[model samples]
Target: MPRFSSDGVDIAYFDEGAGDPVLLIHGFASTKEINWVNPSWTKTLLGAGYRVIGFDHRGHGASQKLYDPELYHTRLMAEDACNLLAHLGLPRADVIGYSMGARVGAQMALLFPQAVRSLVMGGLGIHLVDGVGLPQTVADALEAPSLDDVPDAMGRTFRAFADANKADLKALAACIRGSRQVLSREEVGRIFQPVLVAIGTRDSVSGAAAPLVELLPDGTQLDIPNREHNPAVGDKVFKEGALAFLKARP
Candidate 1:
């Protein structure tokens, strides 16, 4: 229920436990409680003797919502995160991000490298900006409300996407069309911190994790066989791997 004002917007966040801080950023359409709390991430990290801080991104969860397309840019999202860390009075903290949150985390590390101690990026890839492997028509259909009216698999998919009220889906679709700027391999190489990139082996949208593994300066990759994007994070295999990678860091 704790909240703070960042970039003139009221942001909702959860702060729990005590130790070196570990910030958790959830993906698009996922609230802090839905993504990290329900998944036991907060408990797991807390039990490991780390303080966990999670917040609802602007336009998502309990944070301020903006219908304007320009407000949803990755840069703005990153700034919101920076403000949160500053509000907490912490100069640096470990960052763990998933999916859309992963993109924001990467941008934060690039823009404020000193504020980040280590990075754990999951459910994402270097080419996240490249249309996310969805067909152009399917992507377009996500914005067209008439498309949302249809019934069937396509309708379900569109509804799922439109449900992420964090910055209008229409605006997000437009951003994708205009910039196509997800993350890039070059940017991955530029990350100088110790890094861990975890992926579900069966993840279709993010593609293979090998490409990301090869790009990091100091990186380790963990693949959860037979797991999909959402399930991979909770898998014992992933938890063990992630904890090991994070603890290995100084």
Candidate 2:
């Protein structure tokens, strides 16, 4: 329940355990509790002898909500993360980002490289370069009067998740629209840090991992078997691969 100001926006976060710090950024419409704590990611990393830092993005979780779509850019969110590191006086930390967070983490490594020692991008892949994330229809779904009004399959699913999360639909609607900035191949190619891209084999959202891996100077891919995007979060194989990657990262 701790908080910090990222350019005046209140960002809620939790810091626990002790060792190399690992910053955990959640996916769109997911809070830190929903994305990291409830999934036992905090437990997994803490058990692995690492300090865990998990934060709610600006429009999600216990953080302040802004209705302006312009306010939710990943660059600004990425700065929120770097500001958290600065708040704790840590020069750098290993980062693990899921879905939307992976995009933010990539921006972090690109714009604030000094704050990221290494990075693990989960539930996102080649789409990082090829796609802008989620879709405009997702924002439309959020703005829909009710879930039944949403027609897109993925949009309906996201609407349900957002409702279940008790999120501010207005704020999240803007987020889904504003945060879809895609990183170009050249932009991604510039992320010169040890990296791991883990995506579910069945995940239609993340595209493919190997193609994205090909762009990184030091990147590896992990295909989570028999899983899709959401299910892949707490997958045992995904955790094992991530831990292995984190341990071996310099």
Candidate 3:
């Protein structure tokens, strides 16, 4: 397992193929293997002649997990990504991020515009700025002893998220509650790179991908009918649409 130091944390990442670089950022409570490799996203992009790089975010996967709430901020996550790219000697590369990763990607493009060649944002919407409504009750639940009594209402509330299993669900809910900061739309608009925003029509979290579509200065939106967030990554419609859009751009 390859690793690097960034933002006072040790990060784990995977590098494969040999062509125009494309970085893959996984979602909350998801590792690079679960999001990209397990879905064969790396194979799809690599088969199309693009190099693929993926990493596990802090507090998830093989990366160092600090139980500290402050360390999981989106800004720090963004900085970790930027620092990783710099450490690898990559001045610029295409970025593909999903869910929480998309939020981080947005910050990356905003804070380090020159370091990003293009963007493919999946499973997220303008709610990053409009707000996703993480309440204090949810925050308290994260620190609760044993989630055996976790309410069904809370589970139903986050059903749109990928992992539906109890442990995965609890951990994800905790992460969201612990790290609740909104991304700025004004900052999102500042990104000038060609962006491909793909959303699953059935996506529970980012249901209104249209609003996010409108925010991008230069973006193409694709809505995959009958698909949910996790499945969309492997959906033929989604993959082809993104590849075509990326290939057409400089």
**By lDDT, who's the top model here?**
2
Model 3: per-residue Cα lDDT over 74-156, one tens digit each: 87888888888888888888999988888888878888898789888888777667865345555445445545544655543
Better candidate number, 2 or 3, judged by lDDT: 2
> lDDT of all predictions, in order shown?
0.74, 0.93, 0.77
- Please give the lDDT score at residue 194 for candidate 1: 85
Against the true structure, candidate 1 has what lDDT? 0.74
Question: How do the candidates rank by lDDT, highest first?
Answer: 2, 3, 1
Q: What are the clashing pairs of model 3? A: none
Candidate 2 lDDT tens digits, 1-250: 7998989999899999999999999999998998888888899999999999999999898999999989999899999999999999999999999999999999999999999999999998988888889888989999999999999998899999999878999999999888988888998889999999999999999889999999998999998999989999989898899999998987
TM-score ranking from best to worst?
2, 3, 1
Shift of residue 44 alpha carbon in model 3, Å: 0.6
lDDT of 1 by residue, 57-77 (tens): 876778776656467677777
Say what the RMSD of model 1 is. Answer: 3.1
Q: Is 2 or 3 the stronger prediction by TM-score?
A: 2
State candidate 2's TM-score. 0.98
